[model samples]
Target chain A: MSIYIDPAVASSLRGFEMPEKLGFGKVMAPVMFRAVCQDGCWSRGELLPYAPLALDPAAKVLHYAQSCFEGMKAYRVQGGGVGLFRPERNAARMVHSAERLCMPPVPESLFMDGVRTVSAYCANLVPANSGESLYLRPFLMGTQPDLSVSTSSTCEFYVIASPSEAYHPGNMRLWVERENARAALGGTGDSKVGGNYAASLLSVARLKERGYDQSLWLNPGNRRTVDELSGMNFFAVLDGELHTPALNGSILEGVTRDSLIELARDLGYRVREREIDIDELLGQVESGRCEEAFACGTAAIISPISVFGDGEREYRPAKAPGPVAERLRAALLDIQEGRAEDRFGWMQAVEAVGE
Target chain B: MSIYIDPAVASSLRGFEMPEKLGFGKVMAPVMFRAVCQDGCWSRGELLPYAPLALDPAAKVLHYAQSCFEGMKAYRVQGGGVGLFRPERNAARMVHSAERLCMPPVPESLFMDGVRTVSAYCANLVPANSGESLYLRPFLMGTQPDLSVSTSSTCEFYVIASPSEAYHPGNMRLWVERENARAALGGTGDSKVGGNYAASLLSVARLKERGYDQSLWLNPGNRRTVDELSGMNFFAVLDGELHTPALNGSILEGVTRDSLIELARDLGYRVREREIDIDELLGQVESGRCEEAFACGTAAIISPISVFGDGEREYRPAKAPGPVAERLRAALLDIQEGRAEDRFGWMQAVEAVGE
Candidate 1:
């Protein structure tokens, strides 16, 4: 793949040192990939030193939130290689998200070039741990310096990598967000857009004041069905069956959620994608029928849910890290870390740039 | 105002030349006002040359939509002076918007200093016309350079000016949007946040394709009652009585909308702030009871609505610019432009710098 390599990028990468404490999304890699689009035409991708972006004060993304992003990981394989897990899905999902905001999509080829180039150069940054990986964030934002509430004529796309440890929120306690809705019914809920995350911050802050780890958002339409937990998808194991919310336009179609659904079925567990009502799930937890619950996303593969706080009541699940969650997590990690056969054909291997 | 004025600001302002044709929000002023906040403590404001903001790629606002903004105007007032129309209202509203996004609120003093300083320096940019003014945009955004989904500890506040003609979508053809919602039941509808604008863009784009000038969004909860236009408030003259949407949590309490309601009442018209259902409004329009309709905002003071397009049908009001709309618009403009008596105390006179 032919791409522009900034002269300073090699030096930046060579001079950088990884931080000792690699918390999630904290330690940034030295280099990044970038491309621009103007009037629906995309420019070639480039690898440059990671630096601050000069955006006009009136840039559409700054004022109107015309931005979308994807979260994926590049892992250090057992055989001293770097691998991306189903990056094509993130590329396609980003296209959908951009279209929803009336933005020009970054073509699949350019998207691949961005992720692959960044990962190849940052191969040493990929953490060689059971759960840790180099977190890659591919984002696109409208850059046109106009204040009108219209589609921007120009856009910027970037791929930035963070060398980090696995995000583990131990056994989490979730507060049922009854007052605030994360996304509207026909809003940007299904897209990986900035607006959805921004809307969730206040709710999360309120819940945190009450000693909760995250807010369990309910569907905006009914305010009863479980939508999601900020960024991650929710799951519950009831009667040895895995149940999660369906893709109802208001829930983000999380890649980790999809992979877990597929992996659970392959492991002989009954997986169902249906509307899991919050009240019903809470009742099941109260009755001990819901054995375990967890949230899944690329950043945190699977985080166990210990308690659900609703109003003045608390409902605890039968198990925090239940048997089903443990088995599925181990199986997924085995494939991701290259400890097991790549039977699912999920990993895409990339050669290191300096190798 | 004891604010630090950059030396380059005077040069930038002196070099700026107003264009031949001034369109709304298109031609930006040469200088801007800025202030920074760290952990809720605001720094002194500064007036500087308008330039691109250098933001980190991982800034909270860039990826999380943690931004809010206010739209007010500095008008060429009587006696060759400049005045702001109800800027305190905008300041309060912006504080609300910032708090809704879990961001530190811009202090009222700092907010006033920013807007007033920008307006004072750009006094010459205030277009001397009946319907035109120097559009002042005061915005706040989270600027902390961290990728974690949390509130930013640091923020930046800016006041940018645009000199332009009045935004007049003369006799707008509105589409009754039944599908897309601008906001949710418990979402940031009342707050002037970026997410609400981003969500409404697609609906507006779709309506424009169908020969409609704007979309008349409905309540996200019922999808039946009239909410407002994307950035404007909805009003209808029903049986010679002015009616607009009440201050529901899902409706942005538009500054212009509130002023119009107050002005209409003062002008001896029966003002009613109640819910207006879409079906009932269309039926009234069909029966000729709803004589006129219009939308109101800071940029477009009062834009008449000519038609409402629902699926397969169009409802034309009896009067596009009805007597009531005209009277209210003229009365409001008179107060805003300093032609009418300052009975409401809505105008704040500002002394031009270097006068």
Candidate 2:
């Protein structure tokens, strides 16, 4: 499939200047990839200059939340080449998310074209630092101009990029969120839709008041088992073994989480995926059985956990950036930055297009 | 506070023609009301021609669902005058919904101004039929371009109207939604946010496949007690008494539902608000103890439920639109349409501007 390149995109890319400080998802790339879908038929992909989108006020995405998105990064690899880490995984997960909201899925081919086109054109924007990359956000939203609580007949898909530095929460303090559920049981928890994120803001606000970094959410059904953090998967290093919550229907399946699990297994570590009860884990932390815990996602590869505040008490993990977390973070970064061999066949290199 | 009326609005309203057929929320009014909020301060309100909104692709509302809205109507009463029903209740509820999503509330005065301004200008478009009126949708959304999962710093508020007909789901057949929950116990179910409606589309689609019109949602935590329909409150006529699920924090308090309860009480019908167990209610329906069940909202007013399709069995209500539902719907609409005396002081008459 051929993509139509807008003539103005060249000027936008040429006129752009890289900012000295690149925060996570702050400064956007000059160019974007877009495609429209009407009545299940997708339009030809287009690479255009980044601009504000004109949408009808009655669009379904505005009133019914018919939107889903994916987060991945384009890395400035060895020899100044660009590589995308597990782009197909994000495409597949986006399909799942779209289906959960009754939206038509973007074809895998179209998804790849979108990411690759943006990554190739914006290769100059991928940060040269080890932990920094051009973060690509591919989002699809219903654009039908009707104020009804049903499926949308039209959709708009776009891929936007941001050159960013590593987002380090500096040994996060997670509040045991026993009061608010980020996603509901049998709801849009496992999907990367906006509703789950919207439902989490109140909890994040309340946790901020208590001087916490993020929320350690429990399962929405039982409110007992540990689910995941707001946007990352949780892992606890328990007595030389790593244990994380199994993929319950209510927990989002994170790409970084899956990659780390595979990397851990390849490194000869015992990894267990099962339900981790909140109370039991807190007890383990108190008894020194749980050495350290960390959260992982695409934005921040790994965020170490220092303390878990439950009710009136705090359970301190024995190690903040313990040996296990440090090892995994370095291993993943090494692979992502092309410092190590891509033995897992995880990297997809894209040819750069000069302005 | 005075509102800035756009110069083009007068011509837009004058040139607009009502379509021959008006569906619910389909035909948009020619003009709209808008306001912008930066940080915590709001700009002056403005009334402008209804048009598409230009939003940055990275706006928080499109990515994180930081949006909320209210549904209401301006009735074309007797003597061709316009009246708003319980507009203050919707204003207060919009505040709660906005705060739930961490967006700043549209001040009650600002809210009333938006609705009243739109209502007054679109008075000629209000349908004259008993169940038809000018449906007004006042929505607030976070418009910040940042992508982090935090509260938005900038917001946009708009009120768009539609000359809509009565939305009648003609004797709805509800499927016992045992697998999917619309909202979570500690989630945004009670708030009029987009997430709750987004979470409900898949369930509605699934029920439609099974030959049902709507879903009979249960409590998200217990999954036993009745909660509500997608956008409406649930009510049942049991042994000649009116029964509804009590406000349990997970059910959206509907303006129509509250009005019906009050009107029923004044009409000398015993109205009870308590937890209604799903299984027990089904048993009563089977034994002919439950006379009829209906759903209420601003759009539909009263939707009679004729069949409850459980796993393999179906329980039929004794009446589709029972005498109780008909009487209450009429009593409520009578006040709205100015047929009955406004003893409850519910209607706020708005002066219409002639073209």
Candidate 3:
């Protein structure tokens, strides 16, 4: 890999100390991966000391939000080794997101190099505990110092790592958002871009005030079928079958969601991906036909949904942490942490620096 | 106004030179206005040298698009002075946009102080020409360095100025956008936020390739009625009357659009604000009843539309720069450039520094 390692990176990493209380995404690592793109030509990647970026006030990303990002993790394998779970999926999704916003894609090779280099150097930062890993965030943004409402001419990509504990939201209670749409029908909802998350902040704030953990977004086009949560995909176990929202244009194609489906099928369960109406799902929950519901994302592998708050009514699922969700979560984690056989070949091992 | 004028600001202004080619929003001034907010409490505004910002890589604005901005102009007013047109309106609209993204609003006093201070200090930057002015951009963004999907705890507000000529697209050719939507039904369409512009870039890129100037976006919900242009409001002269799309939730409430509607009414032209069906308007244009069409915005006060390209069919207006559009544009420019009386009290005078 033709990557430039800044001399200060080793010193910065040496001086860094991991805090005892490492919350999710709060304790950042000392070093970061950086790359730049001019017009359409990408530069070589660099491992630099993590520091604040000096950006022009008129940079396109600051005003136009032409940015996309990915979320993955570097797990501590069985014998102190680090492995990235489905890093290629994140690389592919990020390219799709960049295209949606008219940004130049970070080449797949560059993406892998960035994630692997960060994982290799920060191997010690990956927490040595079940469900705890070094959360890796790979983001690309337009950095051209122009104020015109157009595509930026230059861009920047960075991979920042966070040494943290697993995100445990306990059983989440979701609020059915009916008024504000997260993204438009033909909008950037399917892409993991900054605008989609920004558009959902208000709805999330409103739900939090009403004691809801997350906003269960509905399809903006129809306003009846279920979309996903803000940063996660939704799933429900109904009548001995696992059901989830299909790969609609407005729904984000989550890596964890797909893996769970495949893993569930392997565990002797039938999985279905189709449009799940909000009203019908709520009815199923109330009638006990839907045994359990859960949300999945890179941050929290599987967060069980205990209740659905739709206006004045509250529908509780039959099981908060059902057997199906527990089994799938354990199975996925075992493979990620190298406890189980790499049967699906999902993990990519990284050589720890100075090992 | 309790603004802190930095000592270096005077030297920065003195050493600055206006570029010969002052295109719209390209030639930036030497100084700017800035303020910081921590947990909803705003600091005093400051006028300092215009420079790059030091932001953390994990800043919430970079990843979540938690940003909003406003565009207005500082014109060389009567008696060799500088005046801001409807500055308070921009402040209020910015507040609305900030709230939509769950960011704290810059207090009205703080917002006015920032704009007025920048205008006063950079008074010479206000170009003296028929369709020229110092374009002022006031923006707010979240600055907290965290990776969680939530609002930032700290924020930054800035007012940047660009001395430039008017934006002229000539008689524009608009493409009727059918596949992509700029903003959703209950999304941030009405707000001056970054996500809306980011989402519209692809559509604009596609339309530009087809020999069109801009995308005439339709309402996302129905995909039939005209919402507006990408950044400007749409207008047409039908049967000798001024008609524009009403203030739909999905259409931005442009200050130029409102001002034109009021000015047209005062000029003895009947103006109607209603839902404009794209098909019906095309039919009227084909029948020669809709004589002319135009768009209005802060950057381009009035841009005449020559043709509308819709799926292999082209509809041309009878009068490209119709009499009504020409008259309205002239009257508006006259007022903005201080060639006429400020009858509506829309202009706020800013005392030039060292005057």
The best candidate in terms of lDDT: 2
Q: Report clashes for each candidate as comma-separated counts.
A: 0, 0, 0
Off by over 4 Å in 1: none
DockQ of 3: 0.90
**Model 2, which residues run further than 4 Å from truth?**
none
Which candidate's DockQ is highest?
3
Where is model 2 chain B poorest over a 10-residue stretch in terms of lDDT?
Answer: B175-184
Residue B253 lDDT (model 3): 93
> Per-residue lDDT tens digits of candidate 2, residues A85-147?
999999999999999999999999999999999999998898897888899999999999998
In the range B1-355, model 2's lDDT, one tens digit per residue, is 7899999999999899899998999889999999999999999999999999999999999999999999999999988899999999999999999989889999999999999999998989999999999999999999999889899999999999999998888999999899898789999989999989999999999889989999999999999999999999999999999999999999999999999999999999999999999999999999999989999999989989999999999999999989898888888989999999999999999998766
TM-scores of all models?
0.99, 0.99, 0.99
Q: What DockQ does each candidate score versus the true complex, computed on alpha carbons?
A: 0.88, 0.89, 0.90
Question: What lDDT score is found at residue B350 in candidate 1?
Answer: 89
Ranking by DockQ, best first?
Answer: 3, 2, 1
Tens-place lDDT per residue, model 3, B255-289, is 99989999999999999999999999999999999
- The models' CA-based lDDT, in order, is 0.91, 0.94, 0.93
Angstrom error at residue B118, model 3: 0.6
